[model samples]
Target: MSVPTVDLLALCTTIKAWGRELGFAELRITDVDLQHAESGLQAWLDAGHHGQMDYMAAHGLKRARPNELVPGTLRVISARMDYLPRDTATDWRARETARLADPAAAVISVYARGRDYHKVLRARLQQLADRIAAEIGEFGYRVFTDSAPVMEVELGNRAGLGWRGKHTLLLSREAGSMFFLGELFIDLPLPVDAPVSTHCGACTACIDICPTQAILGPYRLDARRCISYLTIELKGSIPLELRALIGNRIYGCDDCQTVCPWNKFAQRAVLPDFDARHGLGSADLVTLFGWTEAQFDQIMAGSPIRRIGHERWLRNVAVGLGNALRAAPSEALVAALQTRIDHPSALVREHVLWALAEATERS
Candidate 1:
């Protein structure tokens, strides 16, 4: 059976409209010519900046060649979905900064406080692709939302969703960096949107404010030292040197995004999926540390944090408890550490023992 021909330009216009109807804040199309990003990606990989994320190096340069990854791909549609919760307060930034100051608070990154973005964006991207197929019969396309080897930021930058900020995240003057990105690689010869000029200017707030100095310079990030990577990506014991620097950020860190001046323009999620769950926005370290494996599993269901599993979840909360102990000794905090000190997993026990030691050293 042959696919019917359609007006590509008009179809592009209709696709964008459909995307808006489906909750995507903006959608733009760009040809799959990521040749410009290959070298920088190679340099980042060569420097071992990706840490234990071996998957980043697994695909080699296929990551920069979308057509190679998805053969016959002619155009890529990049979509952005703002994730700041719909009811986010105007003083949300100030509140986040204060939470970091309260040593007993468990600071999960804002994004992970809600449902997993991977599930949300992948489903929506597929819906958009289905809508396109309905308009022009069948089309060759694949939907991706951080699950593949594709260079999402590069594709998004080229698609004019936003320019890459100094922190190396795609930033928009209109919507800032508080959003998720997804790509629809399709065979359609849709007109491509022009790349937008970067607006970072002389601002270095994101780099200067990093707790672990992960942002080495303007755009360089050393993930091994990053609090987010240390708390979430690393499987073994958190490094002794970087453990204290991890502070109370148990799951992920949002310091770079929180301080980025562009985030003031960050829009709220039009969809409810991104809203905080289980009071995670204001959870206490001691309370979170007390959750049994079953409780953690039950509470964190449908959350991005669940991917880390109960053991790593215990590992992270122990680190936060350790940092909290160092800040101010609490019998409750020390007691929580004691309960986990005999945990079956050596990984959890090691972090728990270290946390208990924090209280002793503080005294």
Candidate 2:
């Protein structure tokens, strides 16, 4: 057997350039070893901070060890793609705040409003990998985007992509936390980039603005209290204690990112894939709650929001309606909850009843 030689130094330069051409905001290389992240991962699982996201702990140490996850892995090509729409207005953050205040408007996460990023990033990353293979003559590589056991934030942090913010998401001085991270694990011995130093300083804007106080402290998050987990991840019932605090957030919540001071510099996506679809950015709560399972499946055909399915989707919207009712009782909001009171899913029916109760008590 003959050893295939590679010019690693030049390969690193070529890979980054190709990544930029592939619509990635930035790309950096890092070694596969994640020994530094293992303890933190274990500690989080130990504390049960992951809630019902059993997948987070299911992969065990493979989540921290890329070499174990994909044998023979040497380097991880971490790529960042900013997800904000290219046409996002300058006052977008203010607009988000205003929407939240409206009580009747449904607030889906900006990221989920677009095409499923998993589909977009995975396909693009595969292209990036194939392009590398074409240049380097076949390489051992597997691309991942928010998939499997890989710890993307740690990889992105070590690859000099960004520092992990107080809310436990990667935030770049140039890109904030509004970006998708993908990794191309390869056996090539590419030169590694130095990690970016933490710049969160004493600023606690993200923590202060967290609707559920999901951020226990800097770099510490309790996902159980997180609205995103309650709405999207938890399958059974939402804890009643946190329902009111969830407010009008029907999908994922972005209060932390929206309030972050560094987010002023957040970059918009180079590709149009993330542009808000179906008017999700300004959708009314009653409107989203009225979506039949078929309507949800059809309209969210290519959206990440569909992952929660119409059942959880209704559950979340019901919570938002409950909050809206308490904020100010309205016949439209009450009527919407009544329509779902007999929903086929027990979970949806349970939430619908609660939403109606909120209106009853408040009125």
Candidate 3:
């Protein structure tokens, strides 16, 4: 179907205005070409950096060629939402570092502290699309948020959202790396924005602070060793070598971001949706580990953490508990882990046994 005729420049202006109204912190349009990122992606996959995310390799070059992946994808309307929770303290980075030192604290990635962003982004993007449709009648477009094979970060960079930081995350000088990215592939030929110059000169703070050395080099991340991928993506035994380095981060790791100089400028969410929920921002390992399977489901029903399921939940908390034992051994910590000693999933049981042993060794 032919795309409805619209004044392209005026439309771009309206789209950006609509995006801000929809709570997106920033939005820009880019053509559907991602040839620049294709080779780097292929090399990362070849090096097995994607770990068990076979889908990264399975998609082939189709991922870079959005025009082919989704026919009639003339322009990608990229959007970034600042995800630092609304109530985040001004000294949030130092506060997070303090959490890491508190052995009993349960550190979830800031992004997952609230409602699942996949749902939030898709709904908001669809609203933007609907508003556009209202302005120009029927149109061809599909909204995506961390969905499928979309090269979201590349599109965001090309659209002038921000440069991909050395840690491989999109970083804005104004907003830092505390944000989520989404895309709208549309048939409209929107005027594209100019790409921004990278400002990560001679700064390896992100790489230097990585607990697992996941950042093999500037702009190259080995997901296999990344704590986030280990705790959330890998659905098997937590690799013993990296378990202790995982620290008390049970869901995702923000060490790289917290340490980045640019993140000092990270912006807070305009919408309250990204605010920390259920006191997850302040939860402790023993307290989190003590939740029963039913309690886990009930509390985590609308959370991104729920996607990891009860078994993985126990597994991650167990790793945290074990690390906590070495940091601050207590009868309370050991007893909390003991309650899950006979968990039905061997994954959970083994981690619990390991946690118990960690406490015993400390004693």
User: How many pairs of residues collide in model 1?
Assistant: 0
* Residue pairs in collision within model 1: none
Query: Clashing pairs in model 3?
Result: none
User: Which lDDT values do the candidates have, in the order given?
Assistant: 0.91, 0.91, 0.91
The residue-by-residue lDDT of candidate 3 on 195-216, one tens digit each, is: 9999999999999999999999
The number of clashing residue pairs in model 2 is 0
Expressed as tens digits, the lDDT of each residue in 91-206 for candidate 2 is 88999999999999999899998999999999999998888878867778898988787899999999999999999999999988899999999888888999989999999999
Worst 10 residues of 1 by lDDT: 1-10
Worst 10 residues of 2 by lDDT: 1-10
Model 3 poorest 10 in a row by lDDT: 354-363
Every model's TM-score: 0.98, 0.98, 0.98
Off by over 4 Å in 2: 1-3
Q: What is the lDDT of residue 26 in candidate 1?
A: 97
lDDT ranking from best candidate downward: 3, 1, 2
